[model samples]
Target: MTDENTADSNTSTGTNTAEEENQSELTAVRYADGSLGYPAHTLGSDGNPPVDTIDLREYTAEIITWTKATATPPGVREPNTLAIVEFEIDDESVRAIGQVTTTEITIGDRVEPVYVSELRDPTAGIREPDSQAWDGYRFKPIE
Candidate 1:
């Protein structure tokens, strides 16, 4: 009999191929301790199209890679979520604390990781965005 696991292993080795295709492909992903979350990258964002992009793969060395195999489409990058992260993929460290609000249906440059998809991930972080503060009321002169 033949070793069942041996022959099949060659094709599985192609995992590297997928990475090659994604090389410099330009995607937006959550940056945590420098490691990236799988497949949760955006192909493009407003004003900035897929034509010019940010290579998240380049930032992988900052931390451990954490994410599912599947991919997500382009949408708003949420600042609120990005703020709570204990670490970031960016070269510099961010000590963020603020609040932000918006319609659930809408998205923008600010993208956030869904709790279900990201909370457990080691590299992921929570958001603590700031709320919009109201201005004091103005007084009117009596006629």
Candidate 2:
């Protein structure tokens, strides 16, 4: 007679496979240091991982949740309202900080990531600064 354990194992494996297939193919970028971000990547030779360019720029996401900041911390240039948001990018969750008016955000609103160019020091004249722009990302609602 066939082993009872073997029969149960086959059934469980079949159910797991079906559930996995129903899930989205997207996977989150959970780093070795325990930080999570989007456009999943693996470390490179230089020990820095680059996220996907196409995914960050072209994808539209729905806001899963967000909060408006109410306090100003020391050394902050301006005590502007900030929103800490969690949203999906290609089915993967990403948390990003953005400056937004307190009345602007809403749950389930569609948003997209944006990059802003870093400012240049006027004192460092046109000789071409030694470094490239360190632009950063933010999430904004799609118009």
Give the runs in model 2 whose Cα sits over 4 Å from its true position.
1-54, 74-102, 118-135
For each candidate, the alpha-carbon lDDT, in order, equals: 0.25, 0.46
lDDT tens readout by residue for model 2, 1-143:
21111211212243546533443222345443445564466763346674433334445566666654445443221334345556554445566555432246677777655443332232344544455333334455666
Give one digit per residue, the lDDT tens place, for model 1 in 1-143.
21111211112243655424433332444443343333334432232223322443232111111122223222222222212221244453322221112212112123222111111223233432222211111111111
Candidate 1 displacement at residue 58 in angstroms: 0.8
Sliding window of 10 residues with minimal summed lDDT for model 1: 134-143
What TM-score does candidate 2 get on C-alpha atoms? 0.41
What C-alpha lDDT, on a 0 to 100 scale, does residue 83 get in candidate 1?
23
**Separate clash counts for every candidate:** 15, 0
Q: Which candidate has the top score in TM-score?
A: 2
